[model samples]
Target: MAVRDPAIDHLLELLAPLGAATARRMFGGWGVYLDGEIVVLFARGVAYAKTDALTRADFAAAGSAPFVFESRGRTVETSYWSLPEAALDSSEALRPWAQLALAAARRKPVARKARSGEDRRG
Candidate 1:
């Protein structure tokens, strides 16, 4: 069963101008997608954006921290950071940040192993 949250739906509406944003239940919250790219996630009433080297500085400049959690007796930080304060209310304010996140998502390389049916000889 997929869990749903009204706040996530509201957030998607707020981000609509950027593109068609959709949400899916994931990790006890929701993963927000824009043009099929996962740019944001919501959990515990807070929102986080996917971050990479290209976008990390912007979040740091905004004083936002990467999502961290305790696991296996250690602290683990994810590649996602909280949305900049300026983005919380206005879609205009969030456009750039969402663009950056989308860029980062595009840059993230996908891992795919070679299929046995494929010929490897070159």
Candidate 2:
């Protein structure tokens, strides 16, 4: 069995007020979900909240950086932004940002395309 990270446990505890937040291994780190929707991505011990145009400015104003990574020799910036340092202190501090992330997650459009070897037409 794989060992759990204490940092992740602490993060989950801090997010308890936001509902039953859970973490799963993802992209070499972890993805934090609430209500079956992914609202945060935890990588390198940093938590990033989902963001859209509506909340991106708030994250930027907080001096939070967008999640960026190199893929296929290209740098890619994701819609996820780091949660403000203050938010890590407690659930109360993180509530507003977490809610914003949940809102952004719900606002995201779902993909309608079928993958390879799959057909949507019946």
Query: How do the residues 48-105 of candidate 2 rate in per-residue lDDT, one tens digit apiece?
Result: 9999999999999999999999999999999999999999889899899999999999
Q: Write the per-residue lDDT of candidate 1 for residues 19-106, one digit (tens) a residue.
A: 8899988887789999999998787788899999988998899998888888999999998899977786778888888898899998
For model 1, give the RMSD to the true fold. Answer: 3.1
Residue-level lDDT for 76 in candidate 1: 96
- For all predictions, the C-alpha RMSD in Å is 3.1, 3.0
Which segments of candidate 1 are over 4 A away from where they belong? Answer: 1-3, 114-122
TM-score of each: 0.86, 0.89
Candidate 2 minimal-lDDT segment of 10 residues: 1-10
Q: In model 1, which residue pairs have backbone atoms overlapping below 3 Å?
A: none
lDDT assessment of candidate 1: 0.86
Residue 90 lDDT in candidate 2: 90
